[model samples]
Target: MIDLAPWAWILLAIAGTVVGLSKTALPGANTVSVAIFAALLPARTSTGALLLLLVVGDLFALLTWRRHAHWPTLLRLAPAVAAGLVLGAVFLAVAGNAVVRPVIGAILLAMVAITLWRRRRTTAAPEGAAHLGTTLGYGALGGFTTMVANAGGPVMSMYFLAMRTPVKVFLGTAAWFFAIVNIVKVPVLAGLGLITVPVLLMDAVLVPMVVIGALFGRWLIPRIHQALFDRIVLILTVLGALYLLIP
Candidate 1:
């Protein structure tokens, strides 16, 4: 395992628990995990390590809410997401950590603004089917942000929120989206040499923490009110994005 101070391990354990909670209940909250791992480990190494734990959390999410997935929405996003993933891989291949963090932060902040504006309009005018352009735009951005920093959670949360998805459907869709995306990232990250044996070793020690968090999140989901859920997502997204922009 990679050498780390006791405090560092404590922080990672907390971050890992957040990962589980993010997967099971809150969507944008995982941005905190992205920030934590990025702060503690080399950016690229952190992405790979955090990703495996995310996959583990994804399985639990799937078990909990897989039936709620909106297949049409997933299908609609597939093409643009694939294109964005390619672009993100290219960007990650060349961008320095300093460049990656601020760029992602800016994107998340912009998405938050857009989501808020859309929510206002949607309130004034009844919601309808998601627009093609919006889907493609968010799809591409989600793919890029996820690949670059595992920070796609806020971006996609904005998208789903704009669409006014119900809470259970939102959790289910996000669960599947990240599960597939993270798995696809495996080969790309490995080729980039981010997934080392030490990373796996470290994650092995932390997987149980993720499970613990997932269980807690599952217990909390039904109790959380819809407005409270949305507020928490927005608050966490903004906080995580600001942290990234801090440099």
Candidate 2:
């Protein structure tokens, strides 16, 4: 574990708190957390460290929203998600995150574009093939990006949008999904030699921040209207993509 400067730790704490809130209050803001982690540490090590913190946040999210989760949808996505994870593992080994980052950004942008285009034509939820394809496609995108860079939030957010899920369900289901998936990702990342003790220590200090953020989310969610929540997610996701694309 490389000992970070105090300021770096501060930034990381802020990022972690934001991530926790995003998991519960907003869905797509995690892209900012990933960016902050990557900026503060080595691209790969940062990815590993953030995964643990995310799982902590995930637990909080799941506890808050588990009842609202859409298990049928999660079931449909399972096989496709597995396939994507395998492909993502291969991609991570073959090409480091530098190459993976831009691809993830492009995918997110494409999803956003498609969702916006379809929004005018029909507010009705996508079903059947379109739904399955989205699960597979976004699952693949999420798996690949998360494997290499811990940046899957936006990809999954797009999928939730297409599903036309109610705001709480979207956030709840996404929280459960990421909590389980990020936990599963830990041992895999450890096997890949990305996780290290120093980072673990950092994760420890960061846990409280995640808790605080989760609490904040719990308080905030009931007050805000559903439409406002979705809009915030969309705007934050676009900003996250732009942040990734910038030098």
Give the number of the best model, judged by TM-score. 1
**Model 2: lowest-lDDT 10 consecutive positions:** 102-111
Name the 10 consecutive residues with the lowest summed lDDT in model 1: 118-127
Evaluate model 2: give its TM-score.
0.82
Segments in model 2 whose C-alpha atoms lie over 4 Å from true places? 97-131, 224-247
lDDT of 1 by residue, 133-200 (tens): 98899899889888887878766877787788897898789889989998999899889888999999
Candidate 1's TM-score reads 0.86
Instruction: Give one digit per residue, the lDDT tens place, for model 2 in 1-247.
Output: 4688989888888888887887678655576677667656765677788889888888888888888888887777777777777776676667666765555455546545654665554567575445556678878776766666676766676677777778778777887788777877888888877788888888988999999988888888768676766676567556655665665
Please list the C-alpha lDDT of all candidates, in the order they appear. Answer: 0.82, 0.73
